[model samples]
Target: MLFGTSGIRGLYGKEVTAKLAAKVGNAMGGAGRKVILCSDTRQTSPILAGALAAGAMQSGAEVIDLGVGPTPLLAYATFVEKCDGAMITASHNPPEYNGIKLFSKGGEYSKAQEKKVEEAVSSDLKKAPWDKAGQKGRKDFSEDYIKFLIARVDSQAIGKRKIRVLIDAGNAAAYSIAPRLFEAAGCSVVRVNCDKPGQFTRNLEPKPSTLSESAALVVKEKCDFGIAFDGDGDRAIAIDEKGVVLPLDTQLAVFCSHMLSRDHNKKFVTTVEASLSVRETVERHGGRLFITPVGSLHVADEVKRQSAAFGGEPCGEYVFPFATPCAEGLLSAIMVAEIFAQRGPLSGASRGIKAHHMARTKYKCRADMKGEIMRKISEKPQLEGRLSTVDGLRYDFEDGWLLIRPSGTEPAIRLTAEAKSEKKLSEIVQRAGNLIMKEIESAH
Candidate 1:
């Protein structure tokens, strides 16, 4: 499929090109359709964005271009403007990579929607007549998006407490807006790596390994906490007061716990790859847990379908259905600050949440061989657990579970196994690794 779990993403000039972007735009265009378009800070973003706009215009789709904005902004704009949305971003991928993400009704395109686009891209798409072609216009909605967030959050409480925060935009799309959003919310904002758009001083993905510098700054500056954003600002990673970066699963659990505490509705959504800790914590709060395949698109769709209180991924992508349908990192950051404002420190909230010993590893597999390799592995002997093949192969055991799946965004197979005890986790990991390697060898 041209579309991955999230959107159509790959290396810029190779897998993702201007030609492809234009084709996608043309395929998605229709008469009287309004599409809100934006791009991240990648050098090639402008080219792709323009090509997409051109194609859409040729097909009679009115395009409102928000030249350089984050993915969250594009999503919000789509809802506010009552139009479909398109964002040119590779998300957390490296600089050489770029991709296009399409949104309809304020969320990523559903799998069925994506399938239609793929089919149209392959076929001969029609264009509008000379006078019937659409027009392009420009506007900046950064301030409006900031206002929308501020209106929903406890800005007064956040400001009253004067929560000091360090925001690491990673020199990408969120650089401009995040600082402003936090400052408006009454936070004493400290900015780093927010200077330039295309110049990156750190790894784009906001993980523990990539956030050391930001974490240290949070401690040194005596801030309440810190937030680090990924390349396109769709994901956020938090740094605690003591310069420790919170684990993705732990942070997700904390967010869920906080949200459940706020509303009477206990419907929460998380992905299949989420930690057992998340499930336990949600259930403890009398929240109903819903699991979907490993993608924010799936999470968002499930959230809307079930009227979920909140949805999040272990990777820090959170969807606040009440505020917007998209997985919003900017909103997640502000919500973290509000947690401190309404409650106490995050350290206190994270105290009782359990942590598990989990092992994760990936094996390289040729992209074209993924289907055959997965088929061979699925045909192998079963493990001792309840099995699920929702996104991949998952076996749930009494004390732990094992999951083996092909990476949706890369040419590899990922294995995740978790257990109550370290020894049990190690055993599960060993067995899972052996199974994957044996199948891969046979396929080769």
Candidate 2:
């Protein structure tokens, strides 16, 4: 009940509540010294964070609250303070939802650890004595986190390009960091909807429909490119200078190309849902690509397993183990700038990446019925293509692929189809979507 692919997330005051937060925190059962605690700008973040801290305190763990900021800051703080951390953020979820993202030993808690916590959440455990109760404090690591970010990039090299950039923080978590990260990297940064609070002015998801205005601004201002972040700043979607939203696969392929050129490591890791372009780019560049089940934790775990130097998802989450294990969207934008500086324009890097016609659609399916629906789908007649059930059913062909997976974080079935031709891609999506809907109906 307390954990999912990422963490314990749900609609605030509903599936997620102060009571559940405390229970889960107690179940986490670690007296992590100098535990770093943080939250996003969601109205319920503070109350949830407080409940989480209280739970940890009961376990004799001190809490160091890092106020409001993106999740990556909390990740970075864990490294600096050599402590565990927790960020109360529902990430890209809608404003009414919130979550708890736990950090341990420098990265997210492992699935095994999460299972233990889940078990604890179900059963009560001993609490600390009154005299041994944990302590609570506060820290302002925003400045240090920014300083750390500035030191990681070649500011001089980035400044040489004099690149102008547009940022749409979505009135979410990155509002405070995106601008600073770019400006510090010597890029002229323009921002929109970075200040409104208590409500997200736009949809929290960084999709083309949601970022249309930001994309238009890039073209209007003649900015080199635009970067948009989700509610928690972990997912980043890019818009090109021509006002076209850069497809997630294209971003992954371009960045993977950059990492491949460095010769540091010939290894890249990505989610199975990633576009075929990313896989081909990595292979063609002499880098071995490892595919993991969807989820940032799964990607991070695979990266560690394979000692991959770089990892990312098609959805714009990048994991550079050099900085921290968690995905960092703001840093990804800076990395894009550095890539542009060295590679001239993103078009140059993207030119080698072939674009595919892709369609993504979602159908509402209750959480309880998702499993049976998938089972029905698996039992349906086979297609004339290779099928992979690693994370979901992915039918692969030479020119395209289709992936149908239940959303781990939402009550919906996600359908993704891609092909070299638009008409074929649409047919694939439509056919698969109809089949799933039928199964969902049959289950009912």
In terms of TM-score, the best-performing candidate is 1
Global fold similarity of model 2 (TM-score) = 0.95
Candidate 2 local lDDT, 1-444, one digit each (tens): 457777888889988999888876666545545568888889999899899888888988787888888888888888788767888999888888899988886688888878887888778753889888888898888777777777766668889889899989888888988898788777898888787754688888888888888989998999998888888888788787788887789999988998887547989999878887888898887889888888888888888888888999888888887787888776787888878788876666687898778787888888789888888888888444799988988899988999898888887888988898988887787789889888878777
Model 1 Cα lDDT, one tens digit per residue, 215-241? 889989999999999999988888889
Query: What residue runs in model 2 are displaced by over 4 Å at the alpha carbon?
Result: 29-32
Residue 196 lDDT (model 2)? 76
Report how far residue 103 has shifted in candidate 2, in Å. Answer: 1.1
Clash pairs, candidate 1, are none
Model 2: which ten-residue window has the lowest total lDDT? 25-34
Highest lDDT, which number? 1
**What lDDT would candidate 1 get against the real structure?**
0.88
lDDT agreement with native, every candidate: 0.88, 0.83
